[model samples]
Target chain A: MSEIINSPLLWKGAVVTLQLTLYSAVLALILAFFFGLLGSSRHGWARAIGRFYVEFFRGLPALVLMFWFFYSLPLVGIRFETMVAGVLALGLNYGAYGAEVVRGSINAVPTAQYEATVALNMLPRQRMWRVLLPQAVPLMLPPFGNLLIELLKATAIVSLITISDLMFRAQQLRASTGKGTEVFLVVLVMYFVMAQILQLLIRYLERRSERILGRRPRRRAATAIAGTTGTGSLSGVGGEGS
Target chain B: MPSSDTMSEVPTPEDPQGAPMDKTAADGALPHGSTPGIRFEKVVKRFGDNIVLRELNFTVAPGERVTLIGPSGSGKTTILRLLMTLEKLDDGVIWIGDRPLWHMPRGDGLAPANEKHLHEMRKQVGMVFQQFNLFPNMNVLRNLIEGPVRVLGLSKDEAVERARELLDMVGLVDKIDAHPTQLSGGQQQRVAIARALAMQPKVLLLDEVTSALDPELVVGVQDLLRDIARASDLTLLCVTHEMHFAKDISDRVLMFDKGQIVEEGPPEQIFGEPTEQRTRDFLQAILAT
Candidate 1:
């Protein structure tokens, strides 16, 4: 375990894995929003296109998609670096799931909010950006946190595409040093720690969003409690004297 | 997209004389000296097989306070929805102060209104919904200021000044920073009223504005509305089941049944001596409850 941790090759591989996860996560988020809005559009054709993309990506396995992008695309004069191909495949696959999360969260916003926007005579753009999206964002975070962790774990498959991520480095170490048990155990612990940190970060974001969206009553209650504290001291003195 | 063809060809007439006077003269269909606050001409609306409103024709004169009373599913609320352009018309036209609400001029003819036309027409109207529809994401102050600042193009300071005045009027000056969920139902409805009034709409549609409030809270909301009706010349078209409220505020009361007006007259006459049997029976049924 100590040798594996100290090895430069494994450290380089860890950095590569981190880069892949970050790039793919951002791409997945953008696709999720785009497809989610398209799926919820009033036009049937837009909705159909969004649905087709979601089903196609979700039905195909992520590992197969990685291979298809890396291997098959070159035949059609389309090629990407192995890392880029891995990110694209992972992003597209997980984004399909994220789109469903976005769509469901947006729909869960109360109909009264839409009606209120209409009654105010706000333009459609104003309604969606200012009212609907802000309310939907908090609801979207928990599911998105789940998908993000899943995406982090799914990055393990990218080793098959020769991207030199953590799993890829672990396999090389196992082959050369014949220390399969120690190398695999370290890799497992690293992935679990990464997932735990990601969860803490997502939970922090969820709380911040809830505060901004006025879903949390903590601020109001804190103020009320402060107000009562001053009066309660005065009342306590009076009661003890009586 | 059918309306796209007319978009380029239709001249965007300048509102040189301002919206109110310009609207009446722009459309030459209305007879001289007959500028209605709202006009529904042969308007038809349906939901699948159920006809909500059928060839509904009515006019509320400028500054008139008109109330609609009817049983459930009698299409009273549909009238308010149509006027707000919340629902599209299946057939016919509606005019607000002589400007067609659902159509615009296109080369000596009328076509369905495009987005710009609809936005322009909607500026003249505001609605108070039964649910009080205050934005939960915004504080009471922001709720009142948002429309004026964004749509009316008021400066933030100017909008804040007006919002404060409105909050005072609604007796909720203390709730400027309170979120909607923190307020009582009565207080929320008051804020909704102030929010609509902040728009400075020439016409205000009330869709059972008091129905969602508790019985004790209903009186407070009703009283605020009564104060508003007495204070301004704002045209009001309200759908309500409150017979006493209808009697108090309406200059004219319309009784609707099965998507048509069964009877309409001065509130005193309609409440005291109805001429139609259906109107009498409906009134009796309501009064009993």
Candidate 2:
């Protein structure tokens, strides 16, 4: 524990790791959007091509893809920086899975919503932007929150690609100081705190969407109040509004 | 995913034309009413092997209240969908005022209009659904304001003010900030109708808008629609199984079965003195239920 306090490198490494996770998550989300849209389209060839992408990347292990991009792309004359390779590989791979989640949410929207849009004579883009996507957000939010947490965990893999992120620095300190237990223990607590914050974000989004789009779950206190008020009135008809 | 990017292919001339069209005798517009509401010309619609409309035709005069009644799959909803331009026609032409929708008259042939044409055509029509497809993400007030602000380009201040007025009309002024999920089926459907009215569409298409409502709530929705139909100049093309409401509000009732219009007349003649056996059978079946 004292070693972590003395090592400025460890703090900087934690910051770097957080940044990598943020960048990769954003990249993954953008790619997943188009992939999901294409995957959901009506054209046979278009959907087939999108399906191939979903299956190919989703089937590969995250570690395997990161290593392959880290080592193998030079063969194709595409030499990304280690940091870029790490983020891009993870983002693209997870994007494939995210696309399916997005598409599933889009499908879960009732056809009646679609028919209403049609009846409005809304343009195709208008129907998607105004009617469909808005509803899909509530459906997509919970699943996407899960993926974001996974991506945060995934940032740990970038250390293998030789990026000086938190985990990499943790490893370096472990080797130099031979305090494996202390280093990992500190990072584990840090991870637990990060996960707690991430869960708080998920809950906030869930509540916001529950208010905006999802089924209105009843609050127990409100129900209790109503029941008590009913019984009180029954017991005393003179119970006044005042 | 059930969703599809249905826009990809350039339609070829495998069929004479890809979409259908129906024509009405294009009456010169009344001096006061500049916009021709909706006219159909020999309109035919098919879903793959199933034909929903066949050589069908009807014209809705501006400010007319036309009720389309038929058994399930009688193409009533399909007609509303066609007017909304949600479904492409198999053949025939549809017109809104002087403009042709569904199919554009191309060089010696007809082509489905580009996305731009579709956008321009959408401005004049509004629809309310039976299932109440209010934007679940928006509160009642926002749901009313969204179309006016986004598609109509109304200022947000003006839109909110008008939204409040429309909410008042639907008798849900108290529920303006309520999320759609918080409203009952009746309340939500009423809001849906008001949202459509907020756009001030030249024609309003109501597709079985009350059929999905609970029995207790149906009357409330029907009363709201009746008020609108009585008060406004908006032409209405309503597909409904509510025979009593349809009879009371409709100027003319079009009775349909299979893929064709079996009979159409003033509501009294069609509902009371039916000339077609199919129309009579439909009325009996619905009334019994």
Candidate 3:
């Protein structure tokens, strides 16, 4: 483990792996929001296009996409760096799943919120940014966190494109030292540690989002109000104004 | 039909001077002379095959406070929804001030309003929902100031000042910085009221505004609404099941059934001596429960 940590090549590979994950994750997040909102659009054509994109990418394996972009694309005169190809493939692949998460979360925002914004005379853009998205974000975070971890593990596939990520370095070390078990074990632990760190970061973000949305602990006054007002019967009627 | 005063300007289908029968008036000219605060002429609405409103015709004079009372699914709330432009009219037109709410002047005819036209017309009206749909993402202060700052083009300081005054009016000045979920349902409704008022709309639509409150909390919101009704000359069109509140706040009370107005009269006459058997039956059933 110590030797693996000390190896300059391994460190370089680890850095590349982290960079790939970070870049691709960001790209995937952007695509997720774009396609997710498109999927939920009121226009049938927009929804159909979004659906086609999501299904096309999600249906193909991530490795095949990487290979196609890296190898086959150059044959068609569309060349890209190995890292760029890897990032694009991963981003597009995971983004398909992420779009579904986003679409569901946005839909989960209560219809009343939409009505409230309309009643306020807010434009569609203003309503989405200020009212709808803020409420939907907290619900999206957990699923997003899961996807991030999966994408981190999926970075291993980039090694097939000749990118020297952590998995590629581990394979090289195993071939040179003939110590397959130790090398693979070290690589596995490293990946586990990275995933754990991501989990903690995502958990912190979820809590922060909850705090911002006032979905955390109820204030004493609110609880007291609830107590005085009673439950079920009283609160049920309370929404009559909607 | 209970009183001539309430029935005075109710338009008939053949009333030529009512909504222009000519669908081809594309001059973009604002109608001249005194227009009622709101007028619904032969307005028809439907949800697929389920018709919600049928040939609805009514006029609320400027500053009139009208309350609609009806059984569940009687389309009272639909009326408020239509006035707020939350629902589309299947046929006919809604007039606000001197302009049509659902149509804009095209080259030689009226066209269904686009987003730009709807945004412009929405400025003249505001609504308070039954659910107290305050933006939970913002605090009480931000909620109150959002429309004034964004829509009304008020500076931050001016908007904040106006918000503070409204919060005070709603008797929730202390909750200015608190998040919406931290307030009681009644408190939230008050904030919603103050939020609507912040827009400075000429007309306010209240859709069962007090219906969602705890029975105990109902009075507080009702009293707040009463104060607002008395203090402002803003035209109010409300849908509610609260008889006493309708009696106290409404100049005119309209009893609706299915999708049409069964009877309408002054609050005294409507509640005291409803002419329609349907109206009396509804009043009896509601008051009994």
Please report the candidate that would top TM-score against the real structure.
3
> What range of 10 consecutive residues in model 3 chain B has the weakest lDDT sum?
B23-32
Cα lDDT for residue A185, model 3?
86
TM-score of 3: 0.87
Candidate 1 recovers a fraction of native contacts equal to: 0.59
- The digit string of per-residue lDDT tens for model 2 on A97-206 reads 88998888888888878776665556567778787877887778778888888888888888988999989999999999898999999888776677677867875675
Write one digit per residue (lDDT tens) for candidate 1, span B1-289: 1122232233322221222323321122111232247777777899999999887777777777889998999999999998888888898788898789999989998999987898998888889999998887788999999998988899999989888888887789999998887788999999999999888788889999999999999988997787677566677899999999998787888888877777777789999999888888889999998
The alpha-carbon lDDT assigned to residue A155 of candidate 2 equals 85
User: How do the residues B50-106 of candidate 3 rate in per-residue lDDT, one tens digit apiece?
Assistant: 888887777887767889999888888888888787888889888887889999988
Lowest lDDT block of 10, candidate 2 chain A: A233-242
Q: Which residue ranges in model 1 land beyond 4 Å of their true spot?
A: A1-14, A43-45, A177-179, A218-242, B1-36
Ranking by lDDT: 3, 1, 2
lDDT agreement of model 1 with the native: 0.82
Docking class of 3: acceptable
TM-score of each: 0.85, 0.78, 0.87
Judged by whole-model lDDT over C-alpha atoms, candidate 2 comes out at 0.76
